[model samples]
Target: MAEELLFTVDGPKAVPARRISLAEAGLLERQHLQQWVIDHPELIGNGVKIVTFEFDRWVSGAGSAAADRLDVLGIDRTGRLVVVELKRDRAPDTVTMQAINYAAMVRRFSLDTLADVHAAYLGGSTTADEALARLMEWAEGVSDETLSPPRIVLMASDFGPTVTNTALFLYEAGIDIRLLRYQLYETAAGEKMLSVAQLLPVPDAEEFMVRPRSSSATQAASRKSGERRAAAAQRLIAHELIPDGTSLTVTMPNLVGQDRDAIRAWLDAEPDRARVRWYNDLTAPVEWEHDGQRYRLIGLIRTIIESATGKPPQAQIWPTAWYCIDDGRTLNQIADPLP
Candidate 1:
């Protein structure tokens, strides 16, 4: 045979293309995608368990052959079932409706529906059915009043508007919905990588879930109101403006061990400030008044410490009395010796 050469009139020869596998094309690694739920089961909403299961793979008694073979099912701690529908390429409009059908089947039939199928298809004994029985037990544990609605976890690399809009609408109506977006990137070495990210509810949901007014903010405002209280207590200790022998209550922030020692030394050096009768850690009414002026020393200390570090330090409360006396001086007059 004569030597022959193949020729093309193209401007440049086409380079050989690398073949991408189904897992690689979808950016799914065998390990990460297969056991994804087991690794982070908490992400399956708050109360759901990622169940290892296989449904009938065919719908019967429904009188319809259009039902899809469910890929996975997750039952929550509350015994409500969550149907998970996965799409490697594109999840179209019908997927949600399809998943809902599966959910309906589970709800209508319960795990008892799987008994015959488990023996024939799964080839597992009744012992293997414990996982399914556990689901029933969990459901029975809940009282009828507190049962939550069934949920759906729609997972895919690319999701269309059909599924997205439906999921959002159902979520607003109190139905639990979780969306998992998977991304695949190909490295220069031809290895595929998969990354999973969750889409959580909107910020407004927090408002409905929480009290309209923030407790923390209310607490902060109270602290601000108490500054004058602390200052008033300081004046009561000095006996500057109060009538003699008048008893008054005062609030003082619990001093730390180190500060306590320093103040004790200062008290020994200069006995100004009224003599503290008995310091009570529990302050009844938690408010103090002296000479028609009120002092919330506990709140003031919190403000000071918080301002210093942008966070309030843990504090203890002390309720003590200040009496007008001749040689009683305030905290300013006493200073602990430098350690």
Candidate 2:
């Protein structure tokens, strides 16, 4: 149990510490606790940033037993799927086994499936493809193929001896499982407070226990892969193919007099052209073929502006007119700018 200290000044004299009982505030209901975590997912655990929360997700077992509904499902920053199960009071003896089953069920979820979960949690405001792109952008050095297995987390007001011992045994046996205790407190003024603590693996023993699992060989291989990807990205930037703030001048002619319909038709007929829609609208970004390679209008504009001014363009909206010199013919083209 977690305790709090109360101090009162006694007319310029100091007073001894008065310990307050957090349970005096009364325990919160299970549903209410689940809602609190959904509202502030940061409270789920330390070192975890929740992507999205799925409430009461049903899971099926192999036997004839009924399906189990999970309290919350989330993905961490590194793309590892997280299964969070909450118990309002003391955790039962079989909570660890239950969590293990849940983890097993979700272990084989692909990146696309996880993205779909997030998108559905967000009420279809974004697609799974877009969510995947955003997740990749946020978690550097981690790819869809390299994500770790699903992690299981069990939260409750208190953990029983049987559950705690089982959690420790599973964790030592190489399972990514954690036990968290949520203690509620109330102040003298009728305010509620919460404290969360991670009780498994013991904080002091983490280095000795967790460090040996990430072997030196695996670390070296990961480092080499990252270096190789970085080199490739740098090469692309130098060639002005990737828009990563590198500047290069492209002296193409303006497409002021070119027929818009003709240009669109020509682009449509090109076999190498790839259709890319940044948004759902008629306005399309300029995409064209140059030197047997395809380039977007926004990339060209960014390259030109960055090269000329030594600074990235401030406006995120696409520029009105741009030039691209291809095969010694100055082609004037107009397409929707980036937003």
Question: What C-alpha lDDT values do all the predictions have?
Answer: 0.44, 0.52
Clashes of each: 6, 4
lDDT of 2 at 296: 44
TM-score of each model, paired residue for residue: 0.42, 0.53
Write out the backbone clash pairs for model 1: 229-295, 229-296, 272-328, 272-329, 273-328, 273-329
The alpha-carbon deviation from the true structure for residue 137 of candidate 1, after best TM-score superposition, in angstroms, is 7.2
Which candidate number would show the highest lDDT if scored against the true structure? 2
Per-residue lDDT for 28 in model 2? 51
Runs in model 2 deviating more than 4 A are 1-30, 51-66, 141-144, 203-339
- Which stretches of candidate 1 lie above 4 Å from their native place? 1-47, 52-54, 57-67, 114-129, 136-149, 186-192, 204-339
Cα RMSD of all models vs. native, in order, equals: 22.3, 12.5
Q: How close to the true structure is residue 84 of candidate 1, measured as C-alpha lDDT?
A: 72
- In candidate 1, position 130 carries an lDDT of 39
lDDT of 2 at 129: 54
What TM-score does candidate 2 reach?
Answer: 0.53
- Per-residue lDDT tens digits for candidate 1, residues 101-179, read 7766655544544333333433445342433333333332222222223567877666566676665555554455667
